[model samples]
Target: MKTTKRLDLAIQKLYTAFHNNTLNPECCKQCAVGNILDHTDAWKHLSDNHGSTTLNYIGMVNQKFGKTFNGYSPLELLHIEAQFLKACGYQLPLHHNNKKPKNPTDKEVLFLGLSAVVQFLCKLDNMPDVMDCNQLFQFQPQIKTSKALMLS
Candidate 1:
């Protein structure tokens, strides 16, 4: 399947971050969108809160001007972060008292987060999810199954 340059780069960076133990849901510079933007925290300025999808004044202005960071609009970045955090077991808005993963760097946790982010990225580009394996289960058998054989 074909993929946009930006999406491919984002996926690569995210995979690297996850493997390097640099992916963190609580850290702006290490979050999903942050990693996609090359580990920059500048995207944080686009939103008032860590896990919020609402754009602040600066974010709104940038969106109005049709600006993009690594091929993602300000709103898209926010949504990506929110989705990552949620999949990593973080509560929205990311309050100190809110629920979060016991170990944010756990491979299992980060994998889930990355999976969600990758799926969202695919959705943005109108592509089938890269993390989806349901198709693998849809393979047709070379020989048809007989009802009688099944009963036996």
Candidate 2:
């Protein structure tokens, strides 16, 4: 089980990486999925070792888009915002007057959420300390029970 302190630190690092534009947009998605996968000892080794997971995640994403991951340069994190919005069942409003600002894409919204989560995690120490691993596991059986659940 991951400690809140550790999770908080990871979130802070993630946010810093994003804000500094140091994160590869494609890699960010892979990392997010990989972090969830890391909850299981079976897959934990994949974290910090980008070879297999990066290939796999990119392959999956490419398959979804009917494109090849190979030879495709990673996009800017902001550019993929539309993809996230579509995944979340949002439709960008049509510009009738051609003067309204465009709605944020799904990918942008997702990046924002990821950034916010990281920021929120960084602030956790200031919040009331509540649950230890044992208590959290007890309350959230899904986290403790299986890798699949954690990834899902």
Candidate 3:
């Protein structure tokens, strides 16, 4: 399936960050949205607190002016970060004392975070989730059920 140019770029950057061990849920400049915006922490100014979906004054102004950073609105960026953090086993808002993965750089942990961000990105673009494997399972049951029904 064809993806938007922005989405494709975001995915590429995320893939690079993941492989480079730079994807960190607790770091603004290395999180999902940050990586998508080319490793910039400027997106953090869009929200009053990290991991928050609510946009602050600056974010509201940007939203009012129809501004998008790397093709993502301020609100969308915030949501993406929240999704990544949650999938990475971080407590929302990213407190130092919050529960987090034992190995923050673990491939499994990063994969989960990336999966969530990709899923959310797809949703924003009104596309089917690339990370979804339900279709693989869906066909299996249909074939088995049809054969079982025929035998019955």
Measured by TM-score, the strongest candidate is 1
Task: List TM-score per model, in order.
Answer: 0.89, 0.27, 0.86
lDDT of 3 by residue, 1-152 (tens): 78888888998999999999888877788989889999899999998889889999999999899999999888889999999989989887877888888988789999999999999998899887877787645543344677788998
* Candidate 2 per-residue lDDT over residues 1-152, each given as its tens digit: 34464555455554554465443322334333223222222222222332222324544454457541122222212122223223323333212332221433235644754554443433433442232354655654344557766886
For candidate 2, give the lDDT. Answer: 0.36
Cα lDDT over the full model 1: 0.91
lDDT of each: 0.91, 0.36, 0.88
Task: Give the Å shift of residue 77 in candidate 3.
Answer: 0.2
The predicted structure with the larger TM-score, 1 or 3, is 1
Alpha carbon RMSD to native, model 3: 3.9
Clashing pairs in 2: 80-107, 81-105, 81-106, 81-107, 81-108, 82-106, 84-106, 84-107, 85-106
Q: How big is the positional error of residue 108 in model 2, measured in Å on the Cα after superposition?
A: 3.6
